[model samples]
Target: MKRILPLLLTLVMAQPLGAHPHVFIDTGLTLAFGPEGRLQRVKVIWIYDAFYSLLITQDMDLDQDGDGLLNPDEKAQLTGFDMQWVEGFNGDLVITQEGQELALSGPQDVTATFVEGQIVTTHWRDVTQDTAGSGTYEVTPYDASYYTAYEVTLPVEILGADQCRSRIAMPDITADLDALRQELFALDRQAQPEDAGLPNIGAKFADKVVVTCASS
Candidate 1:
C-alpha cells in the first residue's frame, strides 16, 4: 500500500503542467492462442518513464532495503498494488475481430519488478470469445483521455497460431497535428478546442496491431 501523507502531498502540492498523460509508458504486447487456434489471452507489459518510475518507487516504498532497489517482498507488493484499477478503467487495451469488439477481463498473473530504476509490469487477460476470421482483427492500447501516452517498445508477439500473421500500424502524428490545427482555425469565437473537432485525439494517435489468421 502507498503512504497516504506522501501520496496526498505529492498529488496536491505539485501543479500539473498539462493534461493527463503526465506519465508515459513503453508498451509490449503478446497474443496467445490455445491449441485449438482460438484466441485465449493477451499479455501486456508496461515500462514506466524515468520520472514516474522515481515517483512510484517512493510511493510503493520499493527500496525498503535501502540499497536503492526493490527487494522480493517489495516487488510482490508493487505487483498487487499496481494491478488494482479504479472503477471503469479498462486497462487501456482493446481488441476487435472483423470489426466486432471483444470484451476483455481483468489482468491475471500480474507481476511488477524494478529494472534499472524503472518499474515494469506484466500481466495477461483472456478475451471473451474465440476469434475466427480471415479478415482483419485489431489490437490497440490507448487512453481515450490522452492522460497517458503509450509507445510500442517491441513488436507484438504471436503464439500458438500456426498460420496467422501480425503487423503493427502506427498512427500518423503529423497528420493528426495538421488536422487539429485546421479544426482550431475553423472554430468559431465561442467554440472550444475540446468541442471543435476530434474529441479523443489520443485514440487517433494510438498504435494498432492488425492480425489476420487463415480460416481452418
Candidate 2:
C-alpha cells in the first residue's frame, strides 16, 4: 500500500498547473492646476506580466550523498530579476483641464512624441561573493529591456508667476508598488521561477498628475 501510494502521488504532481489567464489594466491620470505652482509634465507607466512555467529534471545522485538537485554542493545565486518580458508595454495620455479632456482615440489634433518611447538596458557580470568569478570569461554582459516611462509636458503659459501646480492622479501605483514587493516574496516561497513576471509587473500603474498650460 505504501509503495502504491507513492506512485499515485508522483502521478498527481506530474500534471501541469494549467494556463494562467491574461488580465489587462490601465492606470488613469488627472491633473488640476492651482494658482500657486506651475505644472511641468505629467507622467504615467503601464506594466504587464505574462508568465509560463517549465519543469527541469535534474540528476540526483543519492548514492554519493549529493545534498542538492545539483551534482554536488554546487549552489545557484541570482543577483536580480528581469521585468522586460511583459508584452504590450506602451502608454500615452490625454490631458484635460478646466472642463476640456482631450481624447486620444477620438479624432482630434495630437502632436509630438508623447506616447512614444525607446528602451535602454545596461548590464555587467556580477558574482555574489563580492569577488571576481574565476577569470574574466566568467562574466558576460546580459542585455535586457527595462520598463519605459511615458512623459508629456504641460505648456509654459500656465506658469505665469502666480499659478502653482496642483495635481490629482488616479490609480496611483504606490499601493500596488508596495503589494508587488510582497508578491515577489510569495513567488519565491513557491519556488516559482516563471512567476517572476508577476512582481515588478503591474496590474495597473499611474504616475503623478500635473496641471499646467493648454498649448502643449
Candidate 3:
C-alpha cells in the first residue's frame, strides 16, 4: 500500500511519474569437491534490497582440467554460442574419489531458506532458481583451489524450494537499464573539446545480458 499510494497520488497531482522499482540482485555460490572430484560442500549467497542471504549450493562440473588449471580448450569451448566442450551434467555426472566413482542422476536442487528478519528465518524453502545460469569452473587437487565464471539470464526464475509457485515483481530493471546506458555512453572525463572527444550528450545503455540455466 505504501508504494501504491505514491502511484495513485501521481495521477491526481498530474506529476511526472517514473516507471520503475529497483531490485539490486547480488548472488554468491560455493561448492566443494573431493580429492578425486567428488561432490562435497555447497554454499550460496543471495542479496536483495539492503539485505542478503545464502544457501548451500550444488554444482555440475562441465569440464575437468588435468593440469590442475583452467585449460585453453575448456575456455574456448565455453566461449561464444557455437562452442562445445567436455560439458558434464549435459547428460551424466561422475564423481570419482578414493578409487571409486559414483554417478548422480537427475536434476539437483539446493534446498534452503530466506529469512526476512535478522533472527530466526522469516521464510524457508528450497529456492532452486537462485542458482539459475550456467557456471564454469575447474578444481586443482594439487593446490585445493577452484575457479569459476557464470552469466545470469531471465526465463529461469528463482522461487523458494518446496514453496508454492509465485510471481515476483521488480522495479530495478528500468533503473539498471538507464544507469547502464548512461555509463556506457558517458564521455571521457579527461577528454577536452579540442580533442574531438565523444559528444557530451552522456552515455547510452547497451544491450542487456540474458543467460540460461538447465539442470538434469
lDDT of all predictions, in order shown? 0.73, 0.26, 0.25
lDDT string, candidate 3, 27-102, tens digits? 3333433333323433333333321111111011223432323245533332221111233422111122222333
Q: Kindly report the root-mean-square deviation of model 3 from the true structure over all alpha carbons.
A: 22.2
| Candidate 3 off by > 4 Å | 1-21, 37-43, 50-109, 116-180, 183-216
| Model 2 alpha-carbon miss at residue 209, Å | 2.6
Scored by lDDT, the top model is 1
Q: Model 1 segments beyond 4 Å from truth?
A: 1-20, 64-68, 131-134, 175-198
| Best first by TM-score, ranked | 1, 2, 3
Residue 24's lDDT within candidate 1 is: 75
Q: On residues 74-128, what C-alpha lDDT tens digit does candidate 1 reach at each position?
A: 8777875566676666888889988888888888999888888788889998988
Across 1-216, the per-residue lDDT of candidate 2 in tens digits comes to: 011133333433455532111111123222222333322232222222111001111111121332222222322111111222233322223343343433222111111111111111112111112121111111100111102222222222222323334344444457766675455434522343244664323223333344433332
| TM accuracy, model 3 | 0.22
Candidate 1 residue 195 C-alpha distance from true site, Å: 7.4
TM-score list, all predictions: 0.81, 0.22, 0.22
In model 1, state the lDDT of residue 202: 64
Worst 10-residue stretch by lDDT in candidate 3?
Answer: 140-149
